[model samples]
Target: PPPPPPPPPPPPPPPPICQDVGYKVYRLVPKPSVQDKGGDTLELELPSPRSSILDTLTNMLCATCKPLDTPIECLIEDALYKADGEIYVLGRISEDDLIPFRSHKINLDGWADLHLQDFLNLGFHDKNKKDNLIVVY
Candidate 1:
């Protein structure tokens, strides 16, 4: 008989830190006249819900994936969320301890809950929340 196969290595441990999910929307914006380009210039639009570091990643990825008019179809590089303008990505709104979300891992359920409104709020609010503190008079 073949020597006993080594016990399957314990499943690789899960990541130490749970990464947060990031989302972005791509809009068709014309390039500035001042800038000279052969074809088109992919402009990076600020994501809503107050642009965060994570959101910027998505914007940059979509913008960089030029040649292709739409960047949403491109493979996700690093970490980012892609969506068409004015469309809210769908996901359930529920309270669960182990709910599936994507940042490092793609979770359909979590992605569904994302709404365009989330991106629309960008720049309107400070993500760092430093300004959120109310000063009591």
Candidate 2:
């Protein structure tokens, strides 16, 4: 008898297009205060290069004042609220805690070390507090 036709090859796996998309995790540490609680961890998907994560974070933290352009100061201070109704600046993560976000552990050598200040510049013009801020990313 003639040999049966071989079964059709399995459909090609879906293109790995979405695999490139990834997320970044950030810790929002509010300035220390007697009436304030600890910080909050936020996970944000990598936005397009045209958009800024700082803007996204500002929008999430503050709904009232959304600046159209990058301001000269830390917006967190304007957004964060204390039990006493006072505004405070946000703290930056230590260099040790500042690491690049990777979906996998492979080829870590290629990833560069990223410092908190490198991404966000916290300007403390006054000795009493941090006033100006800029998002470098």
TM-score of each: 0.15, 0.19
lDDT of each: 0.33, 0.32
Please, what are the lDDT tens digits per residue for candidate 1 over residues 3-108?
Answer: 9878877888777884435754555544433543447865444323324433443433333332224435323332223443211122323223112222222222
Best by lDDT: 1
Candidate 2 stretches greater than 4 Å from native: 17-24, 30-135
Tens-place lDDT digits, model 2, residues 54-129:
4444443332233334233342342222221222223333323323211111111111233434434322222343
Summed backbone clashes in each candidate are 10, 2
Q: Which pairs clash in model 2?
A: 73-133, 74-133
